[model samples]
Target: FTVVNRNVVFMKELVNKTINLAKLNSDKIPFNIETISLTDEIKNSVVNNQVLFEENDIVVENHVIDEIYVEADHILLQELLNNLITNAVKYSLEEGGSISIDAVQKTGSSDIIVSISDTGIGMESSQIKQAFNEFYKADDSRHNLDSSGLGLNICKRIVEKHGGKIWVESPGKNQGSTFYFTLKKVKKEPLKQKETSISSI
Candidate 1:
């Protein structure tokens, strides 16, 4: 009965992922953009996933600078964080694994770069390059067990929608990995367009 229930839940999640991917591919996803505190949002995501970390005996850390605000769709941003953190937890060991979330403003740009680092089964150079590809899974053996290969793809779409870029870095297998994404920061004051009047010649 337990196995059946688990399978049912997995199937439901798979269906939802498939629907979301379809919506993304068809350019039908809607976003409600607003200015939000990045640090608070990230902390909330971590808090939401506390059970997962606790169950795996993993340590979660935050290095986000306070008062970092950005223009983003709150729901999509949360989804992005959830996907990244889920990946970190999935590949990490059952003990002594640690995940860190960091955010900083990009020099000379009104943008913020966020990274999620994990001490887990890291990827190779080739794997890192294809990490955001649709249906790309670094570890095929565990794909069905924990991943549908659409999470990161969805994350890439969401980031791009916000005029941001996402990428992954790793030293080598077992050395750990870090996924970084950039988002435009909310301007202190909104930009205003100047009006011009036509004059008779």
Candidate 2:
């Protein structure tokens, strides 16, 4: 039963990845942009993946400030976070490690750089360059068949769709890695405009 269930899950993920890739290629994915609290989004992602964290005995620290705001599609942003966090968990140390999320806004730029840092099996320079390529698996021997090798590619497309950029840096093998992405930062949450009805004017 367990094996069958696992296979079923894998198949579902494969289908989802394929569909997402096709949509991304065709530019069909619709994004509903709105003001978002960066910190709250990170917290929500952590909560959504609580089970994964507990299972792996991994510690996740979110240090993003509450004042950070951005315009994004909430669902897509969550998906981006989930992919990065899951990748971190997948490459984490055998005895468990930590993943920290933080954000910094440059002095005069409207962009905020958000980073997901993990104390996991890090990547080399070459691997980092190809990490986002579709079906380009890093260290195949270390990865299970469950990996679709499309997560990072999807993440890249998502970031680009949001007019942002994504990249990764590592301190060599078994050291650690940090994935950074830029988002247009808003000074504050935009005030919601109220809807009004004019009856039979």
Backbone collision count in every prediction?
Answer: 0, 0
lDDT of 1 by residue, 1-201 (tens): 477886887788778878876766664345567777888999999999898787777798898857787877777789899999988887775454899999988899987999999988889989988998877888742222467788899899878877889999998888888999999887555333323221111
**How do all models score by TM-score?**
0.87, 0.89
Global Cα lDDT for candidate 2: 0.82
Candidate 2, residue 51: how far the Cα is off, in Å: 1.6
Which has the greatest lDDT?
2
lDDT of each: 0.80, 0.82
Clashes of 2: 0
For residues 53-127, could you state the per-residue lDDT of candidate 2 as single tens digits?
Answer: 877878999997567888887777888998998888888877788999999986898999999999988999999
Clashing residue pairs, candidate 2? none
Cα misplacement distance, residue 159 of candidate 1 (Å):
0.4
